[model samples]
Every structure is written in C-alpha cells, then in structure tokens.
Target: MYYQCFFFLQIDRQFLRISTVPLLSTFFAELDRYSPRLMEIFSRKGRQAGKEITQIMDAISKDDTIHTRRACVIKSLCTYLNEDPEKLVKAYLDSDFELQSTMEQTVMGVYVILIEGALPDDDPADIAVLIEGVEVLSDLNSIAQACALLFGLIYCLNLSYPQQLKCT
Candidate 1:
C-alpha cells in the first residue's frame, strides 16, 4: 500500500546488537530488511550487496536474486505509486519527463506492489504471487520480479539481516 523506506548507513558495532524492534516495525510485514542501525554497526564491512544482505535475508530459500537492480526498481515503484490518479500511466509519463532522460535501467525499474494506506485490501498472498513470478520472468519482467521477490522476502520471511545490505 503505502511505501516508505528507512535508510541506515555507516554504523559501528556497539549499537548493532540492541533490540531489533525499531528496525522491524519499518516494514508493514516481515519488517526487517537489515535494520538501519545494523548498517551503522557494520559499515566496516563495506558494501557487499548480495551475500552480505542475503546473510540476514532469511534462512529459508531465496525465490530470486536481483541484488544489483534494487535501487532502480525502488525508485520506479515509488514513482508509480505516487502517480496522479486522474491521468494514470500517460500522465505519469508526461509529468515525469525527466524519467525519459534517465538511463534505461532506471526508467525500467521493477518492484513488488504493496498496498496499504487506505487501499482496497492488503493481502500478503498478493505479495506471494509477485515472488512466484521472479524465477520465470524475462528481461523487462525481471525488474518487477525482483521487486516482488523483495516484498516476499520481507513479508513472508520474518527475519532481520540489517547487517546484510551494502550500498557500495
């Protein structure tokens, strides 16, 4: 539904071990995607995207692996959800002229659609469907698949790996 992300950066170890409640509440479901404080704690590790982030993603199986594409998709999905209602996609395109000038990857970001904040329904199963599509998607679909997979990881897998994600 409503989407917002809490970014934690460059943290040292002393604060990393504190109770993870504040970190977990961020996600509407399965809230821990490497808590912000963890990042503050583990900045020493540098940015190890996939493995580092994955280490705390969940112990269960990963449905897809699109670590490299997350940032772009997050931007796109954010843009999509925030679009003006009357015009729909066309208006979104018109209003986002800057998007046309963006790099191809940026313009075509993928993300899982989470519904909240006065939306019709916020079913986690819908998020599950997004996850299932990941492995089978093609190029264009990959971005969407990746986003959906992330939603599944956060919603379905209830673990916190704030120490896992790395920006660099």
Candidate 2:
C-alpha cells in the first residue's frame, strides 16, 4: 500500500524523493518551526524515543489502519514540507502541520497503531513501523528501511483501512 502510494506500481508512477541531506538536519528543520507543537503532543502522551517499550504500547493502542495510513500519508505531506519548509511555516495558516499537528506525533501515532498492543512480541510487521519512524535515520539505507517498513505495514493492513480519500 505504501509502495503503491509513493511509487505506484500500476498508477501514476513516480519516485519517492530521498533527501541527500542529513536526517538530523531534516528533523531539526521541522523541529525549528513546530517543536513546541510537536512537544505538546509528544508530552501529552509521554512519548520518548528512548523508551522503546512505551512507544510500542502507544503504537498498539492507536487504530491500526489509521495509524498505518497516517504514517504513510505523512510521507507525502512531509516531502512537500521538506521541499518548501519556509512556505508551510510562514504561509498555510491553516497549515497541515497545524491541522495535523507536528510531523513527529502523527508518525508516532502510526508507530503505535502498528504495535497494536502493550504486550511485546517479535513481529516483523511491527518492527517495520519502528524502522520507518527512526528520526536520526539519514542514509539511503535507513530511508529504504523506513520505506520498506511502511510498505509492509500498508500491504498487510490495507483491507482494514483504506487510504484517506482527499479528492473525488
């Protein structure tokens, strides 16, 4: 599903832009504009990247299909934001970031959904979500891993939840 979204197999074929830029730089750029908003949401649920276990619990609690799709949609929204970071911040007052809130929280919400329960188990599908959301991930390998996880999540969960239908 995620693969089809970004790199459609049979529809409008396009490539997912892999930023040659460093991951930390990309994360900081968004953080600069939306840190407070991101923090508020992150803190609301006590999200801590360091706390792997809690994060898994959070992901599991979220609506699985919603979480997966949101995580994937975030890629589309985030890529736009990445290309024109200044615009989304200065313009788009009804910003998707504002409407959707920070990029991180929404991604985390997706992560939570993939986990689908507080209890821990070694599930490849669950691990994929976490792989996709790793913030410091900068290299192509990491980005590829992220994409792979997203694809697996979406492919596995598509029937339960369809992608957001924004247009007619």
- Displacement of residue 87 (Cα, Å) in model 2 is 32
Error of 1 at 37 (Å): 5.8
**Whole-model alpha-carbon lDDT for candidate 1:** 0.29
Question: Candidate 2's error at 22, in angstroms?
Answer: 15
Q: Write the per-residue lDDT of candidate 2 for residues 38-100, one digit (tens) a residue.
A: 334433443333233234235434544433333323332333222221111111122233432
**Model 2 alpha-carbon drift over 4 Å, by segment:** 1-13, 16-36, 45-168
Minimum summed lDDT over a 10-residue window in model 2 is located at 84-93
The residue pairs in collision within model 2 are 59-112, 59-113, 60-112, 60-116, 60-117
- How do the residues 1-168 of candidate 1 rate in per-residue lDDT, one tens digit apiece? 432221122111112334333332233233125334443343333344433433433311333233322322333223333332111111112234453233232212232232334232222212111122232221222233334334334433453422212121
TM-score: model 1 vs. ground truth = 0.19
lDDT of candidate 2?
A: 0.30
